[model samples]
Target: MDENRKIIQVLIAICSLFFIIVGYLTYIQLFRSRDFMANTYNRRQYKIEENTSRGNIYDRNGVLLAYSKLEGEEQERIYPYGALYSQVIGYSSKVYGKSQIEAAYNNELLGIDDLSQVFGMVSGSNYPTRKGNNLYLTIDHKLQALGGELLNGRKGAVVAMDPKTGEILALVSSPNFDPGAKKLEENWQSMVESEDAPFLCRAAQGLYAPGSTFKILITAAAIENGMENEVFEDNGSIIIDEREIRNSESKAYGKIDLKKALALSSNVVYAHLGTELGMGSFMDITNRTGFEKEIPFDIPMSKSRFPYESMDKTDLAEAAIGQGKVLVTPLHMAMITSGVANGGIMMEPVLVKSIAHAEGKSNKELKADKLGRIMESDVAEKIRVMMQEVVASGTGHNAAIKGISVAGKTGTAENELSVKKKAKEHSWFVGFAPAEDPKIAVAVIVEYGGSGSEAAVPIAKRIMSQYLSQ
Candidate 1:
């Protein structure tokens, strides 16, 4: 009787274990498998069709920038001015997938958990989908158009911002790719696999040494730290460790005033100033100016990081001239100038202004948020005066616009390491107008342009003049 009882107990235990395993397997196959399958398929088909109508993007003036239209039961996304806004409004596709603005606002535009209702004509009746809202951006269509025209086949980017609101008015990336062209099956593969990688948005992703334009930040740091003396000097080239450093063109402006050094973009003075300030001060300033941070905007933004690790005297000197370990995106440079123009306040840079459903109901409104105060108003004032002098009699004189207080700095960076043929240089300009109570701040970059004055400054002048007129 005892052996029989043991056998019965063993059978019951085996049955219980088998039932438990079966139940768990059922859960895994039914629930977990579906999620995994969805995730796997999302890259190819799920991102657009399932969640939401990819949001319609609009300019500040309510001009349609990007939108999706249904034709013959197929919804197609389109860009009216394809290449002009490619980087800012990244292309959405199955192969290239989504990037930049498309990925940034994918949730809102595709109506994933969106609270607003989207009404659509379905089967001779109106159907409401909680997703599918339109995104209104701060970009001005006319300004963006003009910026592209101004680029004129140059390999570079243009960024314009409202100093007060941190609203980007124009964001143009050159060598633009047409989203419409990619719509064709034959052209898609060629465009994506091309050598240029027109798919890569240069405005936010490309980083380069900013050259003399970096003097703006260095000068601001010097003035803020109370080291703004015309008599300050170092060995003309400070060899902190074992590296030999020399000023640009290997020329020095001996015993010049702080303002004069800024105008000439004297490498010697700024390098010495950077050494005095050290990495701690440099990091602090960049952090405050939003350089060492990510922009919290509706569109995707590349984080701006300044590498300070392994800093020797040589690297620091190079970094002082916006070279060496230091690299910045054009967007980052624009934010720095925007901070200076906004009276030391760093406003969160944004591309999209607001979002709404097809029924015209407001969904998500993009309000400009204050990031932080980077510098004191008084310090900004002093730098403003210096920058004004930069345009009046400095390297940036070419960027001078008539009847406007145009304060700007020019930069010419050598690109010996660039993969492009010719090993061309980079030109950079960052400035704001009406130096007093400024409204617009701009940053322009021309790749392999030879000189900042020769190639980059005129574009800035044209944009600033247009903004001032408006």
Candidate 2:
């Protein structure tokens, strides 16, 4: 009887301990962290006044991207370029609080981290919410402005980056709202409610079917998985599982090599390649390049997905050509270009250059982090030569810049959402300039645009020119 009583007591103690642990874990995970980190009421009471100049945002070369001005008589701040840099430097309205860099770097900008010193004059407040920190971004203002010009009145996105350094130079999204226009529209309620969603940064947030541009990733994968003596002889059409996959425009090419196949962006040839490597092999390649995952970046970025278990042989062929069940954002495409340029190394994309402190001192300088190596050096070199040929003699001929050995691939992917009708195409271009020693890698996508070469390449040209000139 005594032994049974002891066992009961032990069981009771164990149950009580388990309950205590689960309760503590729940409190820590759900409530304790939020209680310590967030003070919404205190934040509202000490909100930065509208009249004070919000901190300014500048490009690496000291070009101003966003600035705040005080209204006449009243101290309320006004945004002159309104929606121009909205995503990068978020709005600081009394009603809207903040977003983007405004919210991310708010502590540094407002000097909240620096607690007001005794010697500091003015209102002599102890918790002096200092003026927002000045930001020096990796963006090139000229490139961003020109990119915006190219995307003007369109519905798409452009992303340009320094391939060697993972520095993002230009990020533009069309159907851009004139920040000033939002304030004057007396029907502001209706404007915000519109379907266009002008407030969102399509370049960073919008996910689209990458189309043929994804072929670049496939090519990298094919070579990585052994193609030593294997050749993709382009006889114009390839038959897989009784499905006839033809080249774009159904053009005929007799007995060309894999290099030429990639140069010409042949769906028939890559479809064969995809089947040869199989779905498992394709997923393996994408995993190395940061696909099917979320990457750590200061800015919000969309994740790339390739969700398919087993597809029809025809779908597999199409998927190999970058057409089926694959969606990507412009930012993700930029990373792919960077991987090719950096010798198959995928570097984490960086927007902020450095963070400065309240007392005019620079704090931590952010460095480019190596995500992972995606291919063998030999494989990367092979893909590089193939991409080079794409510019020198293939569909991407329009992307060539004199003295700069540009390498690029163009993609005209049809939107399957409207599959029954003559599908509206998404124009895409991914390239790196000064190919031998790549400086800039760019990705551009134009929705409902005709051809990638015709619609997207010229915009890249302007950006490359302005960047090299600078």
Candidate 3:
């Protein structure tokens, strides 16, 4: 009787162990399969590449940027425009892995349908040989090409967008590398080691001192705080905590209001205003304008930084004029300019416009999304008028377009290049065309390209003209 009971207990334990194994297997197949497939280190992606054809990436006008073709039994990805769209489309390599949009939308590009994935897992069938979905980007090929041409291998970035919709028209980061370069694997180490940093996406990821371009935000804060009409004496310089701040060339302006102060890009007046508005007010405005936070972009972007801790009078004075620790990306600057152009309502920046399935059916279409209001409509209008004056007779005269009313601000931001030599300031320009009815907004930065009027302004002007002409 005892032996029979022991046998029964052993049988029950074996059955429980079998049930547990089956349950765990079922859970992995149903829930954890996608995670495993998406892992970059997974060897399964290489297998998927062999069986499935990757999707093609296109510009807004249907110009092919990237596509895959079968060479013998192996798949090869090709970039038709080479370096023009390198940073945007990125690359997908078995050896080096993926980046940018190629990594962000991997599943969509692989056409890994959940139902089919499950069926393949359960049945142990070969992966499907269908082409992945097509991605249509918001980028204008002509504008992108033009922006690259303007940069001309310089270490800088250009960003142009529709002010109202936030549709990115052109995003160019110079010193770009060709993902399809012959002997790419051989050149990979050098490219990675190059001081120019071809892999860096300057348009979205590069951060720099905003210089006077940031004054636009300060002006907004002053207006919201009921200080727009306040007057200040600019004797070319101001003393804050015994630290003197001066305008370019130390050219003093007599008593002036906010509009004239911005038009002239007066460092003294802005420094005074920054100290008066206080650090709390400045932080509030910066937070609203997407600083100190990761801006949601189609690809990865570095957050624009601002001093979150309490600042003294000298720090506040410098921060007010886009100095101190305040840093901004070219894309963010373009967005802020667009917000002012859009009447205080900033829209979310968008890149991919639509996606088409392999079966020639539209799968998804992205639309304009509002970020939030930065200020009152009336205040934005006042700033708009001031920006227009900037182009008309202020420091941004070089940015003026023929028969087009342009609004803009120029920035000559100080930066350290080397300990032994004097560094040429970074040139910056942010503006929108047809001021009353803006169509295109642009932000341009030229690294070590002294004088905003000389380097950045002309580039921005040409970009705006090119887009508006079309």
Candidate 4:
């Protein structure tokens, strides 16, 4: 009887263990399968690639940017424009895996439907004729080429977008690498180790002090706080916490209103205004404007930085003048500029305009995503007028185009590497063209580039001119 009872207990334990294993397997197949398939380190993607003919990537004008071709039983992914679209299209390699749009839409590119993925995995079926879907981007090839040309050899970025539709027109980051190079495998190690960091997408990922380009947001904050008409004294410099804040070249502008202050890019005036608005007001504006938050983008983006909690008045003063702890991406700056251009409504940027199957059937058509109003339309208008003054008669004079009304702000951000080592300031220009009804907004930054007016403004002007003329 004791032996029979022991045997029954062992049988019950075995049945329970079997049921538990079956349940766990079912959960993994239903819930965790996609995660497993999407893992870069997973060997299943390579298996899928074996049977799938990867799709091509095209610009808004149908200009071929990237495609795959079979050569002697081996498939080679080719980028026609080479390094020009490197950081944007990114690279898809069996060895190094994928990145950017290539990684973001890998499943679509491989034409792996849910059912097909499961079927292939379960049955080990061979599908040699499977073709991936093509991606149509919002990028304009001409604008992208022009931006690349302007930023070539520089360590910076340029981001241009349509204000109304949130469509990215051109995104350029310099110090790029050719992903389709013949010796890519051999050069990959050195490229990764290089100080230039050619793989880093400065437009979306690089963070830098926005300089006076940030003054646009500060100006909007002032208007929202009912301080738009307030006058302030600017005698080149002001003392806060025993530290003196000086204007560019320590030039004084005497007593000035917000408009003149912004037009002149007066650090002293803005610093004073920053103190007057207080930390609560400052934080409120930054929060509403997408600072210190994830900006929804097709590709990966670094969140623009702003202090989450109130610090010392000195820190606040420095931040108000676009210095100290504040940092931003070129893409975010462009989006902010677009918000001002789009009547205060910040639009979420779109990259992939559409996706089409191998049969040329449209799979999806993307639409504009509104992030809601960052400020009142009237407040944006007030800031727009100030920006116009900036381009017309102020530091951004070089950005003005003949027969076109341009509104812009110039920023020369201090780039100090340490307490002793000081690098040249980063040059920045953010603005929109035909001010009254803006078609395009742009942000340009030049690393170690001196004077936003001298280094960044002209690049922005040319981009706006080219896009508007189209």
Pick the TM-score winner.
Answer: 4
Per-residue CA lDDT of candidate 3, range 310-371, in tens? 89999999998898899999999999999999999999999999889977688999987899
Candidate 1 or 2, higher TM-score?
A: 2
Model 4 ranges off by over 4 Å: 1-32, 120-128, 417-423
lDDT of 2 by residue, 1-470 (tens): 99999999999999999999999988865665434322334442243332123466678887776665544533343444556666666565445555677666655554443123222223433232346567778988778778878888788888999877888888888766644423635445665898877767777788778777888888877776766346656777888888787777788776667788878888878888788778787778878877779987766777887877776677768788877788788898989888888898888888888766534477768878888888877777777888899999999998888878888899888785446556567889998878888888899988888678878888877777678877
lDDT of each: 0.76, 0.74, 0.89, 0.89
Sort by TM-score, best first: what order?
A: 4, 3, 2, 1
- Considering summed lDDT, which 10 consecutive residues are worst modelled in model 3? 119-128
Worst 10-residue stretch by lDDT in candidate 2?
Answer: 113-122
- Write down the TM-score for model 2: 0.85
C-alpha TM-scores of all predictions: 0.82, 0.85, 0.91, 0.93
lDDT of 3 at 182: 54
Q: How many backbone clashes does candidate 2 have?
A: 6
The TM-score of predicted model 3 comes to 0.91
Clashing pairs in 3: none
Native RMSD of candidate 4 (Å): 2.9
Q: TM-score of model 4 relative to the true fold?
A: 0.93
Candidate 4 — worst ten consecutive residues by lDDT sum? 120-129
Q: What is the Å distance of residue 339 in model 2 from its true position? A: 0.9
